[model samples]
Target: MAAGTRSRTGASAAEVATRIREAIFAGELVPNQRLVEADLAEAYGASRGHVRTALGELTVEGLVERIQNRGARVRSVPLEEALEIVEVRAAVEALCAARAAERVTDEQAERLRGIGRRMEDAVREGDQAAYAQGNKDLHGAVIGLADQRTAAATIDRLRAQAVRFQYRLSARPGRSQTSLPEHLAIIEAVCARDPEAAARAMREHLASVARAIAESARD
Candidate 1:
């Protein structure tokens, strides 16, 4: 087998799945774009079998869809469904924030504060890209602090499905400015070790996001 067509032994199915998942999240693999097994196998340095396995796994995660006769493609979540997904994320991530507040170590608290600072800098400099990245980093940090594998896994899958909508929301005029304080509230609550406050802040932030999504759908 050529280097590009490595044997299944080269990369595991789970590894291939992660590569494809990250590609989707990064917008490298766009919504409704066909995922040809042969192309994926070569691009990801995996066997066709592994690519197939990966596609099946991603389908289960709601990131990929198989057409009746056509091959798998990136799933395009509709705006309405996207709003529902955010609603669900709000609940689950609120739980994570509450747990993180209860369980955060001093070092973790410092990290959360650092992320908040970066977000503030990004907004001050009118750096939307940096602010968007900080948004992801802050949420990821809080989830890590929570140490709840189940909730983290759930959030990851939900995020994968709604990443396109997230990109849209981030690019909207004044979006980063509006969301900055909401994210800071989450960070401050978590850093303060106040579980109720953390959960409330998280819920409010996502509620704001959900409302934004709904508003955009009408425009």
Candidate 2:
């Protein structure tokens, strides 16, 4: 792992779980690194049982894997997994975009603008991590504006994995700069109440991510 492991601020097992999940998504927990329960427990000030429990949850998400007697480690996401997630992301985003077009209100629009502004600030500060976090808040706002509870919930679930380990590759080059514009496009399309345009823009944006992932794997 090029980046040193993190000791995040969350205290409880559940909070640690979130921290770990975020680390995975941010590529802080690099692929194939052995996850020592003792190390994690100490780092998070959690019990071994708590760390184990957290690992089990991530395993179900396919973000980690357990070896019979060896212990747990961050899973190396296969090429197929990335492609599948990308496809699902496209479909879900398209639906959300369409629904948002129909349901997004003026207040939601203002809220989104605020989120975008914060995201832009993060970018200007050159804080990729903060920028990424802000981007997530913005996306959640967009989908939440659609008011489709089921769709919103499903996208949230999928995002755990979709976002997992993405930042490792995302840190490569130009991702942060490009992402803001892409997000702005999605917001614009939905604001215009053009479902097809929104869907197409979202699809293209996600597809670009897939291309980046593929290129990263080759490198």
Candidate 3:
């Protein structure tokens, strides 16, 4: 995000933090990447104080690191740390899946179905942008069904870590073709109101992702 995003009236510390975090997650900022305060202040069109506050928040959240006598830069997540994140995500997502199965409404189900359709189209057309958008939609929809803001927030953070690994391995093979089908299976189970099945499917889906991430990390 241009640090100086013109003059947005709704501009606040939290908003600035979120924007910078997303930029870091989207690979606009690489691991161990230094952030120039003046440049960011100018780009964000905010004072150095505002940018500093945003950086402090992001640092606390583990998205960026600050060193004494140095400066702030994006943190580098080790492979072990990445695997731990995947494991935690598996359990939390499984709970959310089961919860969604118990409480999901028809409207929510349809919303998820729409996301699935888009992802399928992306897979068919081999469109990276579409796949990226669809993937976020599918995950966010599931998290929304659970209505657990804390879980959703944590997943966003973990996904940031995963995105770094993806950036490190640029041009690597696409995520497993089977991953989409696995997501669909979980969605179907939730829509069917099959909590047990949904939990199992979600677990399997995350397990597969963990495996894929580990393989890529080793390479």
Candidate 4:
């Protein structure tokens, strides 16, 4: 009986954590926003213990921060930290793309192209959230082709750290429109099975994002 109760508690915490994560990624919960446990418990129809457990998990993921007397709030990565994160992401993803280009199957190549096409359609429709989700999938597809689980996990964690900026960048006028072509370049290189070009394309894509964010900060 005791073990069964603990198992159910763990499941509830995980479910609450997932819903809160979706809220963050979907822009329903912006960075630095305070998360009161009572409110969250009420909102998620979960117990305060479950809410606290979920927040603790997200804190590990770098999506939330717990402060003295402040409880918890969505984390906001500093601009300098964000720049560093992107640089690391560039190197990591570039290698992944290069490796993937050499090993990707025909079906994976087709899926990459399909994700790019869907992104293009999202851009045209001005569906920023959809485009952002596609962008996430596109990056995952590239990493998936690399067949490195450890690298994939590292990238996923870094992405969660950097995603608030990504959403902020997506809100910049014409940013997504310009980024679509960069995605194409990466897809084109992957499709052609050009490892060097794929690496270069991935690097260029991240560089462009860094530049856009920098430029936006200037304005």
Candidate 5:
């Protein structure tokens, strides 16, 4: 009975952590916002102990921070730090793009092209949320095509932190439209089976996004 109760508590805490992480990614919970244990316990319908466990998990993910005296808050990833992360992600994605170009089938290439089309449509309709999701799908597809599970998992962790910045960038005027061409270039290079070009395109695209994110942070 005690073991069963412990298992249930752990599961509840994990669910609560996932929910909070999704909220952070969706911008419902902005950066640096305070995370009160009592508030979260009430909001998530979990015990205070469960909420603490959830916060501990998020803190490990770099999604939340706990100061010495101040309980906990959403981690405000500084622009410099975020740019550093973006650079690392660009390298990881460049490798994925290169490998994908070498290994991707015609069907997989077409799917990558489809992601570009969806992104274009999202931009035309001014749907930032859809565009953000499309962006994730586009990168995820490339990683999948690369077939490197360990590398993909690393990218996923970095992406979790990057999504908030990407979502914010999507809201900037003309940013989404501007990014469409970059995505198309990446798809074109990969589809053409040009590994070097594909890698370069992916790197350049992420570098541009890093610049945009930094610029937006200044405004």
Candidate 6:
């Protein structure tokens, strides 16, 4: 009975941790924002112990940090570190893009093209939200198509850490106009089953992103 209860609690903790992670990714929980155990417990409908455990897990994931005496808060990934993260993503996602091109089915190719169309429409209609969603869909589709669990997991964590910078870049004026072609190029390469081109496109896109991050830092 005790073992069963413990298992249930652990499951709940994992669930709560996922919720918190999603909240952070969705920008509901901003960097440096205090994570009060009581508040989290009440909001997530979990016990304080569960919240504590969830926070601990997130801390290990680099999403949370505990101060000497102020409990825990969302960790603020610095611009320099964010730039480094993007550099790493460039390499990893480039490999994924190439693998995706090699493995993409006809149906998956069409789906990627559809995402490109949506992105195009979003840019033309000046719909930042839709454009952002398409961007996510496109990358997610490529990652899924790659069929590399380890690479996918690494990208997920890296994305979580750099989501704030991504948001900033997305909101930049003329950013969509610039990135739209880059995204389309990636879709085209993958849909055409051109692994080298797909890899090149992915690296070029991330290089542009790295440049933008550096530019932002300069400004």
What is the C-alpha local distance difference test score of each model? 0.90, 0.75, 0.80, 0.87, 0.86, 0.90
Worst 10 residues of 3 by lDDT: 1-10
| Clash pairs, model 2 backbone | 25-165
TM-score of 5: 0.86
Per-residue lDDT of candidate 2, residues 92-189 (tens digit): 88788788877777777777777778778878888887887787786777677677788776665565565543755557777878778888788888
* Model 6 poorest ten-residue lDDT run: 1-10
Candidate 4 Cα misplacement greater than 4 A, ranges? 1-11, 121-130
Error of 4 at 111 (Å): 2.6
RMSD of candidate 5 to the truth, in angstroms, is 2.8
Residue 184 lDDT, candidate 2, scale 0-100: 79
**How would you encode candidate 3's per-residue C-alpha lDDT over 128-154 as one tens digit per residue?**
678767767777777888888888888
How many angstroms is residue 92 displaced in model 3 relative to the true structure, after the best TM-score fit? 1.2
Alpha-carbon lDDT of model 1: 0.90
Task: Order the candidate numbers by TM-score, best to worst.
Answer: 6, 1, 3, 5, 4, 2
Model 1 clash pairs are none
**lDDT by residue (tens digit), candidate 5, 1-219:** 221143443347777788898898777898878999999988887777878888998899888999889899988887788899999999999999999999989998889999999999988898888987898898888889899998897786676776678777877998877888998899999999999999999999999999999899999
* Candidate 2 lDDT score at position 32: 82
lDDT, residue 136, model 3: 71
lDDT of 5: 0.86
User: What is candidate 6's lDDT per residue for 142-179, written digit by digit as tens?
Assistant: 99999999999999889998888888888889989999
Of the pair 3 and 6, which is ahead by lDDT?
Answer: 6
> Tens-digit lDDT track for model 1 on 1-219?
322343635676777898999999898999999999999888877788888988998998999999989999999999889999999999999999999999998998898889999999999999998998899999999999899999999999998899888888888889988999999999999989999999999999999999988777687
